[model samples]
Target: MKKFTVLELLSLELKEHNDLDLKCIAGRKGLARKIEVPNVNRPGLALSGFFESFAYNRIQIFGRGEHAYLKKLEKEKKSENIKKIFTFDIPCAIFTHNLMPTKDFLDAAEEAGCAVLQTSLPSANFTARILRVLNDIFAAREVVHGVLIEVFGIGVLLTGESGVGKSETALELIERGHRLVADDAVEIRCVGGNYLMGMGANKMLGHHMEIRGLGIINITHLFGVGSIRDEKRIELVVNLEIWDSNKQYDRLGAQKKTKEILGVRLPCVDIPIKPGRNIPILIETAAMNERLKQLGVHSSREFNEQVMRWLESENVRNIYFHNNSI
Candidate 1:
């Protein structure tokens, strides 16, 4: 994984919860410093001159309480505590609620070559937002050639060799009211807890699909906002392959298949594509069947049980009839 520098983080043009609203106040030279940890440090304990277990590697955040303490330390000429914190190689310091640090504090930060940043948001809000952003940046990601869609509230990813009609199938699904998430390329991220989330790889062409003959078409523009989604949790994966006359396909569906992505297991099904096969409807049914499985209702298992009962009943009737006839 490449290192994420403070400069890249500061340059992100995010909005709302992902927005840091950060502006560099001082210590520009420390902008190139690498942010090793995703978690942050409040330093409220360190502000009172308690230096034990100081989280210097984590980004330092100064909220209302810390700001007031800095003022008190300045009035008492206790710059020693402030200087003591700068002794460690801290990544950067952020002041929330647009609060300005005292001259002594800034001087210490400047002398130590630590970056100082300011945001208009309050401490709590900025902390939560920044944590969310950092978690995403540090998340494990992979790119796969496929099309992701939301079918009946379930995220289904369709993958196969190039020109296997993956995009066309997704387009048909969209026409049937399903939502397209990503076409052509999908970026999957593992965000802890064995969860796999997927989204479009290209930001500009996320909702657009490139049909073999029709060029690129925007699904959102043609099908309205409901026809596309920003991202979805991949629940199922369907691999479409060319139909083979000699190869045998699973008919009972008793054997469950799974696809592993980023250490997360996803239900997988293989559908062979041939002439005159309704692939889109098959995918829709697959999605609905998966939803049933999630609810602890397995159609394949139930069918197998029913068949076993019938066979046992038939064998008992045949034995009794044969003995009576003899």
Candidate 2:
């Protein structure tokens, strides 16, 4: 089910004023209805204002208000007389705060085809809660642009310029048994805390291969089942860019990099693309190495330490040999 945002619900236009009037106006005065009361409410000036704003009529007011007082009010309105007040049609009513209505009010509302429901909250609080919930129910949804790929059991987002070879690298990764979530355009949504998901556009889902020479081809039909994945959790980002010989690249994997998307931070790596350079192999290696690092193995750092230890031992051995020879 699509969740509506709070803003959307509040923006809806009010149509009617009171249940009876609304029913008469909508030509549904004879139909049974259901209505809910969120709090123990009093049918007075403040309530009248709220009812007017809601534009919905709830005649069987059920709440903590006294039944005898309501019966008296009904008597004042003339036993069978309806005010011809305009309101939106409501079928049922509920009394909250365990407030029961006078027998006359209940009978009158039943004759008018309206049911009432009473909730446990106070009227003021209930009104606020209802308004808030409605607001979220009616907002517009939007999509974003990015790339989502499944690499090493993690959602790896690859983002860069138009021709950064993201697709090509992704294709290579797929061939290496990894999965592809989305290419070129990715739909990113914040599902919740520290989590953002990427999905493919319907038109482009499962359709693949836009390489310079090969226009476009379907991935599932061609590569079979392993080439595509429905979805994956995003764990890292590999941004591809043209290699700059003048610019220094990180030889050691110690410099931590991250890219922020939708206010969430994701680990990021900048891979330079150049002619004759195998980006596919590099990306594959990066994914595997990322998995290793997650498992507490830092290959580059460990290798560096090993080299330093070997050098230290070699120096000591040479000194001993020279001393013995002298």
Best by lDDT: 1
TM-score of 1: 0.90
lDDT of 1 by residue, 263-308 (tens): 8899999999999999999999999999999999999999999999
lDDT of 2 by residue, 63-157 (tens): 45444445665666543322222233543344545455555555655555444444555544555555444332322223545567787687788
- Give the runs in model 1 whose Cα sits over 4 Å from its true position: 309-326
Q: What is the lDDT of residue 88 in candidate 1?
A: 89
- The worst-scoring run of ten residues by lDDT in candidate 2 lies at 18-27
CA shift at 191, candidate 2, in angstroms? 3.4
In model 1, what are the clashing residue pairs, if there are any? none
